[model samples]
Target: MNVTLTLALFIAAWALLDYLKPQFVANLEDNILSFLLAIITLVSFGQVVARYGFNTGWSAALEFNMLAFSWLILFGMSYGIRTRLHLGVDILLQKVGPQTAKMLGIFGGLLGAFYALIILDGAVLSIVGVDKEGGAITYFAKMYKVGIGVEEMKYPAFVQEMFGLKRPHVQRWVVLLILPISLGLLAYRCLQASWHIYTGQCGSLIAGHEAESLVEENRGALKD
Candidate 1:
């Protein structure tokens, strides 16, 4: 849920920036969130020290890893979308006339959909594996039942369960639950990009310099 919120915030911020400021948006369009996350990791280290004194539980490492992955994917995808660089065909499409370009775009989208399905399949398998293995980190294995709702410590509930205790128990890979949905969104975007190309419409959601280039292209096409 924390990862979900982090991703949501990043996307919302990305959308807002795309709406409000288009030119200067390139700064965050690349790696701002990564740097912010690095700062968060540094701060979390202090919190880890404060919470467990010298212990600094290993669970924090797992928790932080999840956070890092969540932010990286969220913001990285935002950057990719903004730049029109999400495994797309830009140069080849540009060389062709509008009709053929549009056809190729639709083909690209269908291809992307197939690839997304493969990724979704892998994600489902990985999630199932997590559930089957009932994996718990070393910290949880060591002090599982010892602490539960004691303070706002960041550890999986399964860790508590392993130690003969109970806490909030969602599925093991609950953090990754939204991944399928995000992949679905990626597929949808591919379809949308294809549609925009076919219809000779620059997509409303295309952002940053990509949006500017799209607008300029449309204008130039209208002149021709």
Candidate 2:
């Protein structure tokens, strides 16, 4: 689990660096979420076909798919913030001048950052668990002391033997840590969006409505 967290942190750092580069186009969250969705779809469809057509299916398929689905939704929230895909009513913002709008957008981002911070704090508490001595347990302490595992999955026997692995089941706490991680990501994105808005690098905190833009485009076409 420590190794998993380290790897995740490394990937996140790389993603942040890539985001800072002007020419970088690939989105780490988008790529990961897309890959997860693809795997889930394939596994689900295969399971259905096997169960109905071949009268046999892997028992772990549903659990694995559900795990992947959970990760997708959890991570997608921050991705939505990064891409400005989340819906927001901007009627008042639209009426404001550019400078005022930018200020308001920054304030909105601060509010979002605060919200994410609260969620992150709660998630951290869950990940850490409570100590028997009525003290707060750190996530690092919990990771080392806890030996919880997922029930439906196991590593292949050959690979397990080769790696000299003791536990057959996947660790559940590692997956659960995504709660804090995703909330942290959401907070980071909120601050980043606010910074970009302040610097005039982006237009607003919320994305423009696609339907309204399409309608306006069609109206101009009709006039011309």
For model 2, the run of ten residues with the poorest summed lDDT = 131-140
lDDT of 2 by residue, 17-135 (tens): 85786245345566788899999999999999999999999988988988889888878877877778888888888898978988999998888877775554434335347322311
Question: Worst ten-residue run, lDDT, model 1?
Answer: 131-140
Using lDDT as the measure, the top candidate is: 2
Per-residue lDDT of candidate 1, residues 1-224 (tens digit): 24325544654565477558857666654456667577667767776786679755554455555655675675465355435655532666556786775676577666665555445443433533532222122223333333333323344666766776445533334444445445544555555566666676653223434655767879978788
Model-by-model lDDT, in order?
0.53, 0.73
lDDT accuracy of residue 34 in candidate 2: 86
Cα displacement (angstroms), candidate 1, residue 206, comes to: 9.5
Judge candidate 1 at residue 30 and give its lDDT.
Answer: 46
TM-scores of the candidates in the order shown = 0.46, 0.76
Q: Provide the global lDDT of candidate 2 against the true structure.
A: 0.73
